[model samples]
Target: MAHRLLLRRFVSVTLRGSSGPVRSRSSALFPSRSSLSWHGTGPPLHHQAVPATARGFCVSHASRVTFNVQNQADFAERVINSKKPVLVDFHAEWCAPCRILGPRLEKMVAKQQGKVIMAKVDIDEHTDLAIEYKVSVVPTVIAVKAGEVVAKFVGVKTEDDLEVFIKKLTCT
Candidate 1:
């Protein structure tokens, strides 16, 4: 019991920097991998859209697995109920378009960290949530602000599109 409590405390503290304090969760229920799960050790502030700088750019999460948000309900709570902006990518492993868009999205993640909670959802695994959002296509990206869907796209989107929308988005 004490170990569980300590673990929860550590996870909560570390997670708060990006996703916020960890709430109740079964150990196995939590995903071991997530690009967004890193705290201040968070991904650098360089845009994948920009030229690789010595300090800002190292490598993208291209070869590594994309974010795994399976079964973790509280995870999205920080996103949907955010004090900033929330962006979600609904994708499938089988879609070639999703594959092409994956690196683009990951690049955005590196740049948008403190400003936005960049999240990804594997529609193949989390069907119900996808249905709720009415995401009918792979690589559907949605931006949420103040717990409401503010911007949406049904196919692959460019970083410029996201940047322009974000420039117009309000975060107060």
Candidate 2:
């Protein structure tokens, strides 16, 4: 119990230091004020009873699969020349939208395994690469083919948009 609280504090502090705004875990884990089960790091957060006053935060229970890239060289080698079109998401751990978009992307990749590959770059950590790609946001998803970027979307994007972009990327 104590460990959970401490971990939650650590997460909150870490998120505050990152680019995106931190969301209330209570609001994230719970939806309405009427919860079936109750748990707490700081306070009891019910899944169904999260009041609108809980906060303007939303957490979608989705799967977001990501590949962590170490540096520009590795990214180039792994994504640029890959047979499958690579979708790189430039994000930071703290970003809210990045968190929301993460799981959705995982499901998307799973559904379109042969046609697309999804990767992530921590812009905060990989500053140089993010700058090279001209990524000015927390969640910039880029579609690359034949070592060149074919499509780019800054901020949250739909899976359908990614699918269409991948289909359009030139295989050079």
Candidate 3:
């Protein structure tokens, strides 16, 4: 069957080096080329030093300042127990003010450069967390430090206001 042939070809291509650069029909369908590569029938190229051009493909989460909260457990672990101050943004997808405020918060937090972190919580998806945190309105941002709520704000705030909030949070 065609499936068997395709599987064999994929396995052979993956396990052994091809004559030259091999482009599969599947890879042609996608905008980006395959990231996987093998060399000279030796071990996969992962063992070798990744080229400078390929460094962009790597993801380093340590540099990330903002992330989504998955559940109550995630909230407790990442926000409550965090060593650095965390700005928990409670929002909903359809909320217009939340949409406007989210990016501004992210930009402000990114400027902190690891001094602060932002945890985005979709109220609709995590209703329990929203209720527990007493988030009665969309675009509620709470600053938590040392497992306690330090400051909170409701609705959209200007970039200057956000910068002031971030500066105040980081200063303490």
TM-score versus the correct structure, for each prediction: 0.56, 0.56, 0.70
Instruction: List residue ranges in candidate 1 displaced over 4 A.
Output: 1-67, 170-172
Kindly list the per-residue Cα lDDT of model 1 for residues 1-172, writing each as its tens digit.
Answer: 8797666565544444334323333321354544355355543343112221222223554423234565547546656667777667888999999888767766765565456666678888888879989989888988778889888877776878766655555444
Clashing pairs in 3: none
What's the CA error at residue 42 for candidate 3, in Å?
Answer: 29
Please report the TM-score between candidate 2 and the true structure: 0.56
- What is candidate 2's lDDT per residue for 22-126, written digit by digit as tens? 345554444353233435543343222222232223333222334688888888888886777778888899999999776666677667645677788898889
Question: Which regions in candidate 3 have their CA more than 4 angstroms from the true location?
Answer: 1-17, 24-63
Choose the strongest candidate by TM-score. 3
* Cα lDDT, model 3, residue 19: 50
91 in model 2: Cα distance from truth in Å? 0.6
Range of the 10 consecutive residues with the lowest summed lDDT in candidate 2: 47-56
Rank by TM-score (best first): 3, 2, 1
Residue-wise lDDT of candidate 3 within 18-50, one digit each (tens)? 354444434423315343443356334444322
Q: Count of backbone clashes for each model?
A: 0, 11, 0
